[model samples]
Target chain A: MTHLVSIENVDMRYGGASGTLAVAGLTFKVDKGEFAAVVGPSGCGKSTLMRLVTGLHIPQAGHVIVAGQHVTEPVSIVGMAFQNPSMLPWRTTLDNILLPLEIVERHRKRLRAHKAEYVEKAEHLLDVVGLKGFGSKYPWQLSGGMQQRANLCRALIHEPQLLMLDEPFGALDAFTREELWCVIRDLHAAQDVTIVLVTHDLREAVFLADKVLVMSARPGRVLREHRVPFARPRDLEITYDKAFNDVVHQLHGEIASARRAA
Target chain B: MSAVIEDIQKSEPARPLIARIDWVRASPWLYTIALFAIWEASVRFFDLPYTVLPAPSRIFAAFYQYWSPIWKNSLQTLYTTTLGFLMAVVGGLALGLFIGWSKVIYAGLYPLMIGFNAVPKVAVVPILVIWFGIGAIPAMLTAFLISFFPIVVNVATGLATIEPETEDVLRALGARKLDIMLKVGIPRSMPYFFGSLKVAITLAFVGSVVSETVASNYGLGNLMSSAQSQFNVPLVFAGLLALAVEGIVMYSIMAWVERRMTGWAHRSTMSH
Candidate 1:
């Protein structure tokens, strides 16, 4: 299996030399087209790792290679969503989704000449996320769940090879979160893309990810890796299965110990 | 979902527009008329001297008597104020964008701008007269100087406050600094820019009148000063009335422009 993203012995610190260390000697690899989840204690550097891989921050030590190139600057091949939807109030849903095409150089040059095609593409993504006919509405007009659905469409509009989600569903209620989990599952099944999800929910990790990596607290590094043996197209009903509960419980124990060790 | 939709519907006005009384819109005119009525009644009951406080009726009579000079001076004041305000709009926007573009420029220039704004613009009029030598130029320059500060401050604030997450979304796509400014920063600053215009227009009127009083040969300010020296108190009151009308008209125009340009910034309730 070929790896699309590889981080080796990475060390990242905020501020300068005397600054707080966020991650130390962190190493991981995500296979091409795989759904990988990183879970740990609350203060663990899962978000820091996301930033490092996306080239938003440079590690003080070691390497981050993505798509066969060193990530020294912000890379163009990745799509990112965060806990906050943070949609621009001035833009409609379709315009917001088309923002990346207006910025990414490959699409920007051709965006004007082929405007209709891009609009069609954006509309299609909105439909897939169950936001059909909502393209003209301003973001503030939408509910929280609907805005997040639009955010997901915006992330996927550029058809990026790698999707980085930093607690995308962390702010949703339990039912809404579960509904989105199915949306993400279907999206993953349909798209030929690699995903790296940073989440705190162990069941979410066990259900949506092909592999789960557990990390230690604060100056975080991967402590253990677990392969999810569940079959694809897994149902939410499996969450009640004893075997699924066992895996979630085992990961829960690992996180509890990791927090205590801090 | 049905409950949320119902709540939104409940919040909306159910009555037709013509059937409802818009008290908020009518209150200003009502209050102004009531104030004039009270002033007129008190003046007549007391048999007050016209020089001390002319009745609104006497003021209007004087307005009819001196309509020619009053109309000319009013036009002059309006012209100087408008010219000065247009200059401020262009200059303030450029300076604001320049200052907000980088931290170094913002730090270096902000204190100086605050200091310059602190000095009384009325005091600057005499200096302006010394340089420009008593005409519309002094009045115009004073208007420009006095009115530009609010625009600069508001525009800079708008640019400075772009959400960090929004910027990250753009930067992660390999967007350059110019791209970020064009795509988000400028549009984000628009509501602030329009809001400042209403304030700046009123201040521009103040600047023009103050400079005209001390340094110019024309404008309502000069006419009022001359009328006062001759004890033509009704004419002076007429000049005040003209200034008041001009001020209200200019302010209303600015407010209308603000709404037209940046309606997106206002919520539906506020917009209505």
Candidate 2:
């Protein structure tokens, strides 16, 4: 199967830290409709990976090919959600969710004509995220979880074929994080879009990923990859199963080794 | 936080008998009535000479007596101030956006702004008179000078304060530079913009008053100056009161605009 995204020997380095490398010799590809997670310790360039995939950062060394095009600058085809959610404080919930559409083409052209339809779309997404009747409310009025849900909905609103999540649910409580994981899972399943989730949570990886790619500690490199064998339409209960624990333990061991190697 | 407002509200009625407690709660009418009562009583109680101070009743009588000329003068001042203030808004918004959006220009012009602003706006009215001459021009420029800085400062702050992550999000969404400016920068900075507008309005009023004090043959400020020169103290007091009333009316109009523009803020006040 043709991969939706192909990473060819990628290397990334931010100009800030003197002679420090964020990621090196990293290579991975996500197949069409696949859900992949990159797990690592703190400061392991997990965010850098997201930037690389989203075309926000150009690789110093190999190529990043997404949807059959080589990445040079930021791309519109990818939808992204950051850990902070970072919704605009001034805009209403619906307005904030429609932020991408306001800037993106085709939608911008069609916006004046199909404004009501778009509003209906945003409202439906809000409803699906359990935020019905909050379309008029600003970001500050909502709880952290609600904002994060809105963030996810915003990322998915344009229905980009590739979704990039950089620790999107890291700030939420355990319950809220799990709740968002289900929300994301349902979204990915319902749409069959490819997702690249960069997370530190092994349980999160095990719970939602089709394949989890483990990266080393600083100067992150893809050290190993594991295919999670759980059936489609994953539930919170499956995480308690022995197979889940086995995979988690194995991934935990790999992370421990990666940390020791550092 | 919510409890604080509720507690104050609940406590408002409990101790009712102590000198018309509910009267204070009815702040709108109570404020004006109390002010006029104290004003009239103070003049009467001290038996201060009428030339030094006039009773509120006398001022009211003077207000009616000079209704046409006084109203015309007031209108002229209002027109000049409003003109100057609008120019300031446009200039402030344009120059402010320019200076604010660019770090280099901010560095280039910020110090100059500081220096110019340091010189009291009124101090420059004589120069404005030299440049624009007498009548509306000088008065309008004075108002413009008075009010311009706050808007520029506030608008610049508003324009420049876009969150880094938001900029990043827009970039990732492939938004053009213009798109970022119009979509993210402008609307995001509205609250700060309104804040500046309020400050500018007051400054504009100050401008008109100062300008009229110097050059204008018309305007409420000119009327006040004439009253002061003629030593008609009650008329002077009446002009001052008229200015106060005008200021309140102007403030209320702007405040209403603020309310309409930012209705989402009503959610906060709704709990009250």
Candidate 3:
């Protein structure tokens, strides 16, 4: 199987020489078109890993390769969403989604000449995220869940090869979070894009990912990797299935132990 | 959800043009009239000398008696204030962007800016007078000097406070610094820029009046200073009243412009 993203024996540290080690000798590979989730105890550098893969920060040691290219600077083929859903309050929903297009050189040059076409593409992504007809509304006008949905649409608008979600649903209420899970599930299935989701919620990891990787506490490295054997097009009902709960419970236990080991 | 949209719309119902009295709109006028009435009553009952504290009637009569000079000085003050404020808008915006462009510049310039802002601008008027000589030029320069700091501070603040997550979203896509500024930084700072105008305009008026009181041959400040020497207390009050009216009008205009340009920033119901 072809690997879309690979982080090999990486070490990341913040500040200067006396800085804290966030991750060390960390390694993971995500296959093309796979849904991968990284779950760990709090402050285990899950967010640092996401940053490394996206080329926003270079690992102090070792390699982070995405789409077979070494990440030396920020790569242009990734899309990212964070927990805050930090939508620009000034831009309308559709305009917000189109923001990336105005930045990525491939689209930025053509966006003005082909404005309507790009706008249509953005509107379609919004529609798929269950936010149809709300494109013209400002972000503040929407509920938190709706703003997150717009955030997701913005991440997808550029048709990125890899999608990185950093606790995207962490701020939502339980019902809204589950609803967004289905939204993401449908999006992954429809777009055929590789996804790397970093989350703390074990059930979220089990329900959404094709493979779940658990990491140790601070100065983290992958402690274990578990393949989710569930079939494609999994339903929310499967979350209550005994086998599904077993996987979640197992991951929970691994994380609990990791926290204890810290 | 549709319910949220409905809630927003329902909260802001359209009012008829000839609806019953809007208490909020009428309050300022009612309070002002009441204040004047109380002042008039107090002056009459206490038999206070008009020279010490002029009655509203005497101030109005002085306003009519010296209408020509009052109008001319008022125009002069307005001219200097508006011109100085416009220069501040342009200069402050440029300097703010330059300061906000990098961490090094922000760190290097911030202390200097704070120190400059700390010195009383009234002191600067004399230095301006020495350089440019007395009159509207010194007054205008003082106005510009006094008003630009708030704009610089506010605009830089707006730029500096951009969410890191928002910046990351663009950086992941290989956005250049200019692209980030155009798409995010400049637009994000617009509300701050416009909001500062109201404050800067008011400060600009103070600046011009101070300079005028010190050096200028014209302006309401000069008129009031001259009237005080003559013991024409009512005329001095007339000049004060004219300055207050001009200040209110200018502030209102800035407020209206802010609402028109950056309405997106005011998301709270209280803003309405």
Strongest candidate by DockQ: 3
lDDT of candidate 2 at residue B2, scale 0 to 100: 38
Interface RMSD of each candidate, angstroms, one decimal: 2.1, 2.8, 1.8
- Looking at model 1, residue B55 earns an lDDT score of 100
Error of 1 at B167 (Å): 0.9
Instruction: Give the higher-TM-score candidate: 2 or 3.
Output: 3
Pairwise TM-score winner, candidates 1 and 3: 3
Task: Write the candidate numbers in order of decreasing TM-score.
Answer: 3, 1, 2
Error of 3 at B202 (Å): 0.8
Candidate 1 chain B has its poorest 10 consecutive residues by lDDT at: B1-10
lDDT of 1 by residue, B137-237 (tens): 99999999999999998898888898877777778899998998898999899899999999999999999999999988999989999999999999999
Give lDDT tens digits, candidate 2, residues A108-197.
Answer: 888888989989999998888888999998887888899988887898888888999888888889998888889889888878689999
TM-score of each: 0.92, 0.84, 0.95
The regions of model 1 sitting more than 4 angstroms off are B1-22, B42-48, B268-272
Give residue A246's lDDT in candidate 1 (0 to 100): 99
Give the runs in model 3 whose Cα sits over 4 Å from its true position: B1-20, B268-272
Q: What is the interface RMSD of candidate 1, in Å?
A: 2.1
Q: Rate residue B64 of model 1 by lDDT.
A: 100
DockQ of the two-chain complex in candidate 1:
0.48
List model 2's recovered fraction of native interface contacts, to 2 decimals.
0.61
Which of 2 and 3 is ahead in DockQ?
A: 3
